[model samples]
Target: MRAARYLRLGEAYISAARGVLAAPDFEQVRLPFYGLLGHGMELALKSVAARTGWDDERLMWLGHDLDWAWRVTLSDAGFEVHGARAVGGVIRQLSRPHHAQAFRYPALLTWPLPDPRCALAAAEAYLTLVRDRHG
Candidate 1:
């Protein structure tokens, strides 16, 4: 239940991000876009973990660590991702800034951004998988 909630919330954030990206002033709002995407990934991965019966305490331990969450989902829980490596590459790219609050805060640096489409696809698949298989 909690897992599905996280997945739904993650989808909402990503959907909001797409709206932000569509705006004319999108260049000036890049930070918000990045932040939303990172946070979305975080929630989606948390959903995967929670589906496996991990408690709130363990989930909190992960915090904003998208990479670890993705790892747990991919290798441990065995969620079927079409391009696991590529999706992982996207998660690892977002993990550092997200974990450090860099995306939400003003800790911007030369962040090597990955394409969100892969991550987005992976997240959607995760959401669907958890809802269908677990429920």
Candidate 2:
């Protein structure tokens, strides 16, 4: 259920993050963060599942819109990860030694925009929130 929650949040965040990126000023940059959010969700899902022992199929059965749920959660948390490089960077950031223990949703408010590195940071917050509340 926790994993499902994160996935849903991730899906929702990606859409809003993309909207921010596509805003008049950011339109020129056109970073395309939705893809990055999806990638981040995929990576986070796999990683969290592997670590938590929730198989892919089991997670799939959690809900049909889990991806959307993840997106919404991330958006509510204010994470704005977008792009492949940004996604990778975020994952790396989250993978760092302290993230699993220290990252939090408020961190997203200060989270740098247009940086893929923030994806992992977002993931850490999502996972931590779910784990803390449900685990």
Candidate 3:
């Protein structure tokens, strides 16, 4: 299924971001790392929509709207939100008041970001839950 493929890609992106975390020049790539994570999560939610028989056009409409995609995913019966809090928090932190774009482009705002390790773990947990339940 496309969802499964997207899920795999999502994990790959998150994994790639995590690898960058261990690098000595973390600050240099910090922005890109957040972008990667946001993208990975976006794919996760879009992939879930794909699983629900939504076409590419519908998924495309979702764009980078993580909150909307997440809402759609949660509409599924028994989404098994084992680590929903963390993922939800990250989504909130990324989607509301600002957007994933901030991570990709320079912004005049400054705000605390979620810990990379914890964010990675939460992402993995969320993906695992989705895979186990629907992948």
User: Among these predicted structures, which one has the highest lDDT?
Assistant: 3
Please, what are the lDDT tens digits per residue for candidate 1 over residues 26-53? Answer: 7788778778888887887778878888
Candidate 3 wrongly placed segments (more than 4 Å): 76-78, 96-100
- Pull out the clashing pairs in model 1: none
Count of clashing pairs, candidate 1:
0
lDDT of 3 at 51: 85
1 or 2, which is superior by lDDT? 1
Per-residue lDDT value at 66 in model 3: 78
Any residue pairs clashing in model 3, and if so which? none
TM-score for candidate 1, please give it: 0.85
Clashes of 3: 0
Name model 2 segments beyond 4 Å from true.
27-47, 50-87, 93-135
Q: Model 2 scores what on Cα lDDT?
A: 0.44
TM-score of each: 0.85, 0.31, 0.86
Task: List, in order, the clash count of every candidate structure.
Answer: 0, 21, 0
- The total number of steric clashes, by the backbone 3 Å criterion, in model 2 comes to 21
Looking at model 1, residue 35 earns an lDDT score of 86
lDDT order of candidates, top first: 3, 1, 2
What does candidate 2's lDDT look like per residue over 1-135, in tens digits? 555555556556554555655567754433334344444455444334433555567655533333443444344444334443443445443332122222222223232333443553455454454445444
